[model samples]
Target: MSLHDPAQLMDERRRLEGLGLSVTRYGGAIGLIGLVLACLMGFIQENGMDRFFFVYLTNFIFFLSISLGALCFTGIQHVTRAGWSIVVRRLMELLAANVVLMAILFIPIIFGLHSLYHWTHAEAVAHDPILQHKAPYLNTAFFLFRAVIFFAVWIGLALFFLRKSTEQDESGDYKISIRLEKVSSWGLFLYAMTTTYASFDWLMSLDPHWYSTIYGVYFFAGSAVALFATLSALCIGLQKSGRLTRAITTEHYHDLGKFLFAFTIFWAYIAFSQYMLYWYANKPETTGWILRRQTAPMLWVSLSLIFCHFFLPFFGLLSRHIKRNKSLLFFWAIWMLVMHWVDIYWLVMPEYVHQYGEIGAAPFGLMDIFCLIGFGGLYAAGFAMWARGRSLIPMKDPRLAESLTFENA
Candidate 1:
């Protein structure tokens, strides 16, 4: 009955694979088709290509945060010697691997720098005193160099942890556990630094003239929320496919829901804190950023986020029954995912297109859907590939038995 029995664990994994493969394959195919259609739409629509380019770049940056957040989760599980999560950590590892795909997607962003980022243009920078001062740090060369370093650090950490975990799966050596613990302890620190800086470079810099000390933390909060929502959805979908039925229980769903709930609050707090501080100070520079968002149609989008992203989820997930109920949880998870996209859209689009009369639906074009589909498809494909031919759970973990028997107090 010991969960660490290699023979039994392998047998269970084989059984789960047979059940899960068809669903996973179907999902991946649908995702691929959606992406292709989106791309075509982008090309067909007038001025769509430019909009698509921006959407693509933004989604690419957003995926980078998700991928890196997954890396952070994987490292934390190892460092904490968390057994309950051992069953799910491999899923995270695979998601982390999508960081490579995200890095590849960054090419469009690099090429479209002039279009997506105003500060990237010499004419724009020269006219603005603030941008001119920031030119040294915000120039194309430094931007590219920082991006390369960010990916190098992220990919290095993901591969190292994944490699070590796979090696331990084969050898079943205790020493490998110790090594992972050591690596993840330091790796978490690096993750925090890298993700914060990446957020600053990719997102915060969109408004180069404006700055917030709390912007990085705000990004982290949103990233964690988005990632938790993704994990919950994935787990629920896998379970419905009749995989991980026994390995992952309602308790796991409950725990995931709690994290999602906590991060939702954190995201709201950071967002409000950032806004409140700027509003109270009433400084021209800080208020200018808010001014762009608070007027016209963008104002409605901001209000929608308050309701969809914070208020709705805040109360919707409060019930224990809802969190543990597979169907309800799945619905909420999908809702949160959509809201996160809107949140990002609100954050980046207003700044990029503020001159277009404050939102007015911001011209919901094919490019947005195409970029999302393309990036999401690639991410799903990478995850599926990583999940293939591996034990979904770390069966050899010393605490596997404890995890299987875990229950909420």
Candidate 2:
């Protein structure tokens, strides 16, 4: 169990066979019940279907961004030939692979397009010049096609990295690392472009007229924060459940906390950069999006993102002692995860409310909570499914030895 005994890592409890089975069963049940209840609430309430789709989209984007962030992080580690992360990379890979699950969840949003997006309406586009101008790119067919392409690329990259990484587990071949490095070099470029355009299609186009060149980066920053927080939380949870108790150490948690802290700042920077540009430009189309969020309720949500999302966490995570403390890191991890959802909700709900002419009304409701619980359960189920009968860490990764012996200077 000691770091000096690298050979003992091979004897670690790599598979989650016991705990994973229980999580999959209970998490799937909870997910299904939550989704069904949210559906019933949507039908029972007035204009509830509209609220359902927007709330669903908000939660959808929130979870999907986490997977997308995982994919990006996995690729970054591979391309950089990172050693400190081999102990944790498999967790990221599992999260990335759940993009396949996100693809399945996306079907509901397709059906809700008319409810969620203004540009999806043909008559409205015909009358509006801006929508007309953006029509070629925003039409239903093109939107779906782009989505398919995005998922295809993401799934392909996810499977390749995961398959090869797992293959290396058996073969213990260093060549597998070379192959992964080659793919990741170009894989990241594709990741950047697809995530950018996908965010544009899914989130930005909600407001057909508003545009920001940095919106994709904004999403990516938050996604990175989500991935690190989720990873930190997962590692802590796994250790608590008596899995990988020694293989993953305080050292790894410290590094995860540092990334969590770093990306928290990065997200705030991108958020402010986007906001500052809109404030400085004073452009009607872009400013309209910002102004809508400035109204009551949402204004409070916006303020929360400013303080809770950034300032509060910035100071809370400033100390090395805090990052190194497992208990403290777990708290910050959970905190960042909640803030990331608020950030996604802030990005999405304003447009949904603006469409209903209820700019003053806060869109927070039971349905949002239900949808979040639904997605959270399903996310847990999918991750557990991928994790079952598999090593919690990449047991045979070439750099795993380095990770096992890694220390912060």
Candidate 3:
């Protein structure tokens, strides 16, 4: 029953039988098929491919940023020499490992470049002084180069930390811990830099003329909240399945809930800060984006994000009792996960609605839900595929004892 008891550890491993890897495989296949069908539907429609690209990039950035945040969280844990998270660190590691899969998913975006990015077209660049001025940085070649670099840095970091962690599992060398701590400092810096620029390239550049200096931070906040939501779900799901119930406890779930609660506030803060700046400035270019959201159909989506994404969760998770209750935390976690989609949908879909004027549902286009399912299913598949056979906890981490015995003060 103790942390050091091998029998206790082995018993947790016994609970992880199959762990639903087949489900992921089938789900991923279905998601991939749905994505293909969605693309075909778009290509056949009037402005179909463009709409498809919009949905693709929206969901891509959503899931990609989630993995990036997970990777960043793992690196932060390593860099800080954290003790309580050792039990959940393997889950972070596996989620981060999905960055490799995300890099591959980006390939289709490259093919649909013109449809998504207006800057890719020379004539538009010629007419628009801003696009012309930003041509050097926003050009197709340079953009592709930066995307490759971002993925390379991200994937490299994911692989390095994963290998080291798994290596520690086999070797149990304390030096490996020290080594991870040493590298994570620089790794996190690299993560921040790459992610900031990547956000500009991928999401912010969708409207080349519109810009926000805090855009990257806003994206990071949303991503971090979504990732924390995912972590809560995974941890709770595993516990429900009778896995990691020993190494992980209600105390750990409480901490995860606290994180979910905290980052929900953080997302609202960044969102407001960004909006506050643009609203206060009242510049036509900047204000137009906000104006569009506040206008008609999108105004509703924006308002929903407030109550759904911010205020509701804020009050729902404010209590210590709620944070500690698995059912309540899981409910909020699932809620946020859906709201996270709504967040990104609000960010992307409104533009298309304004231009094309009512594509799918109110704010979201017709294909938007399919895109979400496609990406969610695929992301789950990636996380599950990597998680299979790996320890439900970091079984060999020396500090894992500390994690298993963690108690909140």
Candidate 4:
């Protein structure tokens, strides 16, 4: 039963495998069905088929953000060799593994380029002098090429770190840890540049005419918030399953709560700063985008975000006691996740429906569910499989002992 004994860990792995098989079977089925329903609904709605392409593209990018953010978190922990996060790092690795699934999901985005992005229309691009000027860089051929490079780099780095960490667990090798640290240091820098540009290429290009220099940062901040929320929820769920009962304690939950609170504020700050600069400058192009969001249903959703995403969580999580309480933190984490989804919906839905006078829930349909389920089910299934035979903690980490005994000062 010694923590460091490889044999004891193997026994634990068998228990985990049994747990995973049952969870994956039930959870995967429900998730797949829900997603299929969303996709079907999308197909049924008027213009739903066309809009489905955009929705799918958006979901794919959102999933990519989660996967990449997980990769970033894992890299950061290695580079810093932070001890406090050892227990939760496995969750991040599992999430990062989903990057491969996201890459496959991106194919729809490529095929639907003409439907989703204005720049993809040759006739439209030819008439617009500005778009024409950017054509060399914005062309479909270049776009696909860039996407492949981005995913290849991301997948390679994620797998490299993950494999090294897992191998080190069995062999008790410190060199693997050191090697990963070196890789992660460089990986972090590359991630920053790639994610920013990827956001510009995928989301920002929806409105080719309107541009924001800070758009990438805006997306980056949101991604971080979403990732933290996701981690908190995942940890809480794992605890509920009776695993990690000893390893993930109130102290860990407390720190996770603090992270969630900090990122929630960061997301709001970045969002507000972006809006304020554009609004104050009064540039026609910049203000026009805000104007579209300010009217009708988008406006209400924007205001709801002010409360649900920030103000509610800000006040709710302010108490030290709240952060230390599992149930309370879980509730806040789930709430924040919902708000993040709404935030993304607000960001994307406007681009497609802005031409219409005001926004309305067009209809609930299949495409939405299909894309979400198709992607989400695969993500969950992969995460479960990844979790099956590994110590949830990095057992051989030089810092594992420190992490097991860690206390916040």
| Predicted structure with the largest lDDT when compared to the true one | 2
lDDT of each structure? 0.77, 0.91, 0.84, 0.77
Q: Distance from true position, residue 48, model 2, in Å?
A: 0.8
Give the deviation of candidate 1 from the true structure as CA RMSD.
2.7
Worst ten in a row by lDDT for model 1: 1-10
**Candidate 1, residues 257-316: lDDT per residue as tens digits?**
988888899999999999999999999988988887787667888898899999999999
- Please report the TM-score between candidate 3 and the true structure: 0.95
Model 1 bad stretches (over 4 Å)? 1-8, 14-47, 355-359
lDDT of 2 by residue, 1-409 (tens): 4354557876677788878998899999999888888988999999899989989998999999999999999999989999999989999999999999999999999889999999988889889998888888889998999999999999999989888998888899999999999999999999999999999999999898989999999999999999999999999998888778888888888899999999999998999999998899898877999998887879999999999999999999999899999999999999999999999899888887789876545878788888899999999999999887778788778788789878888
Pairs that clash in candidate 2: none
TM-score of 4: 0.92
TM-score, every prediction: 0.91, 0.98, 0.95, 0.92
Best by TM-score: 2
What total of clashing residue pairs does each candidate reach?
0, 0, 3, 15
The root-mean-square deviation over C-alpha atoms between each candidate and the true structure, in angstroms, is 2.7, 1.1, 1.8, 2.7
Instruction: Give the Å error, residue 381, model 1.
Output: 0.8
Better of 1 and 3 by TM-score: 3
Distance (Å) between predicted and true CA of 397, model 2?
A: 1.1
